[model samples]
Target chain A: MSTIPHDAPAVIDARGLNKVFRDFWGRPKVRAVQDLTLEVRSGEVFGLLGPNGSGKSTTIKMLLGLLYPTSGELRVLGGSPRDAATRERLGYMPEESYLYKYLTAQETLEFYASLGGLRSRRRRQRVDEMIELVGLASARHRRVGEFSKGMARRVGFAQALIHDPDVLLLDEPTSGLDPIGCRQVKDLILDLARRGKTILVCSHYLADMQDVCDRVAILLDGRVCAQGPVRELVRQPDTWRITLEGVDDALRDRLVAYLQEQCGRPVAVEPAGRSLESLFVDVVTRQRAASPPP
Target chain B: MNLPRLVAIVRLTLRDAVRSRVVVSLLAALLLVLVGLPLLVQSDGTPAGRLRIILEYALAAAIGLLSAATLWAGCATVAAELQDRRLFIVLAKPVHRWEIWLGKWLGIVVMDAAALAVTGLVVAALVAVIRPAGGADSQFEALLSARDTFHPDWAAAGLVRAVPAAAGDTRQFEPKSVALLPGHSLDFTFPVSATAPGGPMELRARLGSARPNRAPFASLWEFGPPGKPVSVVTSTNAPGLSMALAVPAAAWSPGGVHVRLTNPVGRDPATLVLGTGVGGVELLVPRDGFAVNLTRGLLVVFARLAFLAALGVTAGCLLSLPVAVFVSIFVLVLIASAGYVQTVAVTGMYYIPLESEAPELGWLDRVVLGVFRIMNVATAPLIRLEPVALLADGRRVAWAIVAEAGLLLGLAYSAVASLFGLWFFTRREVGRAGTE
Candidate 1:
């Protein structure tokens, strides 16, 4: 994917999309998504956040063409996702690892790569790169059926990236991963976005979304309750946060008294603290480095 | 359209079958039917009868077992994948739905071909073991050779007329059989190849009496040139007796094989009626070897398998695993019993109707019978492909018959099935209609 401007064109666009699942007799059973309109710009990370049965997964499925919209339009790469040619430039990692139990991790990647239109030499090269990228080098030959949930998710992630697709629809990217794996995945999302790849992440991990997503749409009860850039949506206009260094306790008490006299309201000042995620990442990194896993 | 994609699906299907033990189970079951059945089953104490047992019973059993396996594999290949949700990832890739359907079909067809080849080899070996000790004996010649038979020219012999002679002549002679008077003589002529080597040939006929008691009857026969005739007399009390008599191949003159029959005036003379159908009144001349005929028989069976594979795969495209298998077996049963369907369609019954004189059908019977009649028309060609029966009788499985089966069963029917399957599956929502 080539580098693009900050305002890159929307690669995944949906307008007033509605998905109403029907029962066996054709009566509407559940309206999973309603007026679900969103756009994922190229070279950006877009997160779809919602709770269970809140239409997050359903919307992702419609974007991937696994489920058709009941009304309105949905397009990926400026074409119908149902088209084979359009899917060639798309990758998807489902929430659950739906892998062939009979195949090795390496074979799984090969199968997807081949279906993704890779030739023999290119397919081999990509399969190798993906296996290595997912840290499955040692388990490349092991049957995916024998893998743990975390390992299977890694395989799923590798398969999605095997074709070097320009757009990735990843559902619950860090659902089954450890802290390190989660951090690694969040870093990969950032890295992919830097390389001008469009990514649509669907998950309930609010902190993970805050770390990686540039824009987000929050769905509740089959409708988009809120949407915008993360900064714009989370910013509080009436408040300001300031971090200061080298201030003595006596001087800080005097400054707090002056602010309280100026505003005629209670004033509080506190030292800024590092986020727990950063601390966890630091502890894990140093421990792994010191142990040098065998 | 994409070759690599199709190859990938086919490879995946093969691996699934192998890992799931489906292929191994099928091979073991086929071996039991092919090798074990021949050794354990009892046959009439003759080389020909033993060979018949192997060709007819054992080979048919092998075909039956393989057919079931092919159908099961075809269904499971798609239905199981869909039910398990493995197709979610694959379908999310740039693969067309037809590629998935066709690739699975090709995989099953390859497995079927390999199994059938194994079955053919084992059956051939068994037949070789049961061959007569002295290769020059009559049983050896009859069992190992494909003989061509020629029937009587009843029309030329004035025994049967091609058209109705007078109005209301409802004597049932249109299908052609003659009732010879007590002492009256009837001349029968069988046209032979004239160049069909001059050796000993056999004459076979289904004989019966027209009397109410169906009493015993005797007949005198003379074969060869009218000048120097070889005479033989044969008798039997069983009505509709299947008789095989030896005739010297030299009896085939430039004109043809000529035979005359007479009812010896007092030799329990009852009016005799002879069948003019196949093997009714004919001379058998050894033409080819049994090996070639066996291969032709196998080809016919392969054609049959192709149709069945198409049927199973198509059924799997729409139904779940259990339901797909049920539909496949149901269709297979109906197709296998096409001949029976035809008979019942005509008589409106399989059993004899008791006190009411004849069977009658209600509305459901009428509709069902109508549907079966239509199916009979469509499956007529399939029913005619009787390879096992022909092979057992040492009759020639002609190349023309094989070509017909290949076109009708293997090509036309399979193409139609594949077209419908691909169309239906391409439109079907892959994420729907599964166990989930």
Candidate 2:
């Protein structure tokens, strides 16, 4: 369901990016990133995959202008990422919530909305919309410091989208969420992609990423080890899976035997099962419907 | 430039300070000190002395407490957030670095203003509730009233040995000394411009002798021209003690009036060696009331607090929380010892020279002064008027002094610190992890 055209313009462009961390004495200590070249086009959900300390965060920081590349050329939204004008159209959610503990959810959203240059009336509307979007309307008046990790994450997500930015760089978008929350976040990413927003997500949750990402890059030790369309990268070319409902064991056996005889090869058949995330979402949906909030 | 954005940041900062209970604790401490300080201290048994003790010590305590808190909060604001990774979200917004700096500074200043107002009101209320006894009013009137103080025109009287300080010197750090022998008259002329024969004035004289004058003597003080003189015999002659004698309104002549103090109006003739230095012999004309004077004094304190706010924010921008706090406290110490810094700049004596010791190198003075001058960008000419002392001593905190302090400390010096902060923070990489 990728809406990206072949001739889509690049929203985030990086070429031969390198980052070398230095010690107190200005000596090169660790090469966090080496020779990275990445392009995230408009209207795509691009996922970055890596183990801990594999330069994923460093690359994202560079793209957000939080850290300078030791050597590279980077363009975000067709301009230098450090520019305020360039930042105006970009939204970012850090790995941690990183919100003011003293502020309530409503105040936090309103603060970001104002910073994004929303007028007073529109800011109120957006704050209300974002609170509802994140399912935190009941908890809007409570201080963020009192929120659980998942609730704080929800607030963080709400703030990032408050400005209605076209490009989003989300670090670990579903780090501490429950299964239903994870599914909702994945669906939200797909919905945003459908609306022509470019998103760059970094996470270790491959299953969550696989459900939404169109293209993915797997990084190891600061370098790209593998990259391509998710379908092509994860596709098993030598095997196939077929599923049919209402097939008894004898009928299934007969079909398998006929396939093996015709192909002159041994074939195996197994039952298809639903993903845990899907089942969990279904259960939560039924429970919520049974006893909805008044 | 973005008013709404800055306002948002300011509101958040203020809310943070209040919720964290830091500002509340500070306010409580200030209130206790202002109300409790007078009750604890022992005054000179006189009502005026008691009032002076309360005003001086309580106000000083308030200023000291507020200043330390302002610096501590300033240092902690940005540095703590950065360490906690809270700044990542804020910085990711479309904010220029200068706006953030300005917003935080404004927040601290607003907090200080509110704190000062509370402390001032408490002190004023204390004074009102414990009104002084009836007889002491005239004694402390000249001290508490905001008046234009005038000293004897020593240059015109040919008693001055060196060049006099220029006109409008707000704080006359040095004093003018004059001598008067027994059986001789000392004419002290004060040329003050007032609409001829102006508002009632007083002659406040605190003259010292080579030896303490234990015995009382009769001295004839004649005001105005000899043709129509208003002769008054003042007999209280404790030389070191100050005495305020009311001058008749008619005593002020067209241009100026000369007061001739002839010692020994009787046969006793106790020599009044007039050592006019510091709180010396002077004329006082009431210009404004006590409330207006206190307001002016508070304005100076506000300017100083604003400067400290900028300095603290700038320090926070460049360092970690603990390090920033240390650096800010060090700067605060330096500012607190500004008088010492000034002494080093003027006399170039880092240490008092030992008896018969050789003078240091000639270049030493230049170097010391140069260093202080360089530091002037960070700590401008603050505390020049010593508003607390002025308030306690009953001297006027002139509008000229207020304007000077405001422009230099609040506006000009703060702008420099803020500019440096903005430049460094803009170029700094806030997301830099530890090396490697």
Candidate 3:
């Protein structure tokens, strides 16, 4: 992984990719992906945004080589996604945990590590690191069957990263996680991107995409409806929001009147506040700090 | 190709089998078959009968139970995981699809090996403990030791081409065709160059009389060389008879041991017909111990399980759980009923035509016969492995037969099944995330 140049070619590249699922008679039933041209650059965090049944999971499966496109080109790590070497450098977390119920958390990670071609010592080390990173150390020895949905998700996340893959295609990474786990995952994604790891995340959570994505492609019905940097895609030049600090009631009223006269319309003013996610995290952090687990 | 990945999948599969209590269930079933079967079967008071009960009924029941358990486990290990969506995690790794197939096979084989070893030891111990206390000693010995059957080489002895000149019969003295006249006698010899258990040798014979009544007749046997023959008298009326003769060791010549059957002038001219081929005459020579022979039989059974495991896994790889189980059971039944298939294959017919003396075939019979023919081509070698019968009858389960089973069932059949399985599994679209 380290041998690759920092300015390497795009890790994920697809052009006019189409996937048409067929019925028993081979007649096209659903065009799950159509004319989907997208590029995810090296060291960048990319997001696939769409609503339910909007080809998000389908596109992710294609990128992971779980499905083949009906037509056009698709590549990951400058080679076909179906290539074993390309898959070796990739990590995938599916929508569900899909873990072996009989294996403990540590065993699951170790199993994945072995599949990643790690030797005995390195596999053990990686398993330990992954369990610790996922905050599953305390429950590492417990079978995954006994874990809650959130814990299973955590284990899933750990397994995906146990190989320290250079690229990750995570579908609904935070679906079953609590706010804390979600925050930790988002932070971990950012940290991984900072270390030059290319990540492609598929999620319906707008805030999560906004927080970590350097670039995003929003799809609808198997086509990319929008693509660009997060700011560029969401920005509206005609509208603006300004937050003022330490402004009194009189100053605020005068400023709003001046803006209304200058714009030739009535101006609206509201206090800028922290997002609900941030507030919840703050409350949870403080409470946990007040009475930490022994 | 990837050793670690293969090992991991196999380990995980074994863990699943253990955690799901499949291993426990199989052990319990094997225990029930081994312990409960003796009580289920009423053994005759004779030691030979009791030993036959153990070797035939108990061992067969154990094999049947274990075979079912093996097939069920093989099917469930793969099919259940696929249905439960647990395979996605492993498939998502950098492992080949064939590795998964091979791994599941290895796990099932290991489980079967352990189960067979434990159950076989238990049955063997039970057989030893319940052995009758010193009665019908020869029959008991026959059941415990493997004996090689030797028949007279008639062609080598130049008897098949000979014509009895005294009666002026030009026909050859072939078995079942030859009729010894009242004044004439027939001579037969078998080479006993090999060591026989230093005791009286047993001769199994089937003699038919030309008389319409098939009345009881007295026959005289002269054992040893022509110069010095030991005489014995025995009455024969049935098609099959067993006669034990004690002759001095010195009586056996370097050429072979010779025995002559003569009929003194009876009430009417009596005729004797010898059985054709080896069936007419045989010498049973004890070869090995019962324990070793039992182990060889178990090895053959294990080879059969290997083939069954491959079959179940292949079915599971391609079909749903219920369908796979049904198909596997169907295959098991077909294999167990191989004797019927063999009959059909050889006779080239299925239903015997009652209207005619010979078997006649209809169109449907032809189709069924064709199917049986193809099945026999694929399964004849496996079908010939009658381990339970061999063990009960104290016949040697030769290493050559074991090797043949390993080659045909263990290697060839398993390889074919694995190829099909890997192909289906690799092409299978695992896109459905939900469990079936």
* Top candidate, metric lDDT: 2
Models 1 onward score TM values of: 0.91, 0.92, 0.91
Worst 10 residues of 2 chain B by lDDT: B168-177
Predicted complex 2: CAPRI docking category: high
Clashing pairs for model 2 are B143-B394
Q: What's the i-RMS for candidate 1 in angstroms?
A: 1.2
Clashes of each: 1, 1, 0
Model-by-model lDDT, in order? 0.82, 0.83, 0.81
Candidate 3 per-residue lDDT over residues B67-98, each given as its tens digit: 88878878887788778767766776778778
Best by DockQ: 2
Model 3: per-residue Cα lDDT over A29-138, one tens digit each:
88889999998888888989998888988888787777778999998888877667888899999889999888899888888898989999999988888888989899
Q: List the residue pairs that clash in candidate 1.
A: B199-B249
Off by over 4 Å in 2: A1-3, A258-268, B133-136, B158-176, B195-220, B224-250, B265-279, B356-380, B434-436
What are the per-residue Cα lDDT tens digits for candidate 1 across B13-100? 8888889888888888888887788678887777777777788888989888888888888888888877888888888888888888
Model 1: per-residue lDDT, tens digit, A1-294? 223456679999899988888888999988889998898888989989998889987777777777788998998999998888888899999988989988999999998998899999999999989888889999999999999999999999998998899999999999999887898899899999888889999998999999888889999988999998888899999777767788899988888899889879987676878888789989989998999788
DockQ of 3: 0.66
True contacts kept of each: 0.82, 0.77, 0.65
Of candidate 3 chain A, the 10-residue stretch with the lowest lDDT total is: A1-10
By TM-score, how accurate is candidate 3? Answer: 0.91
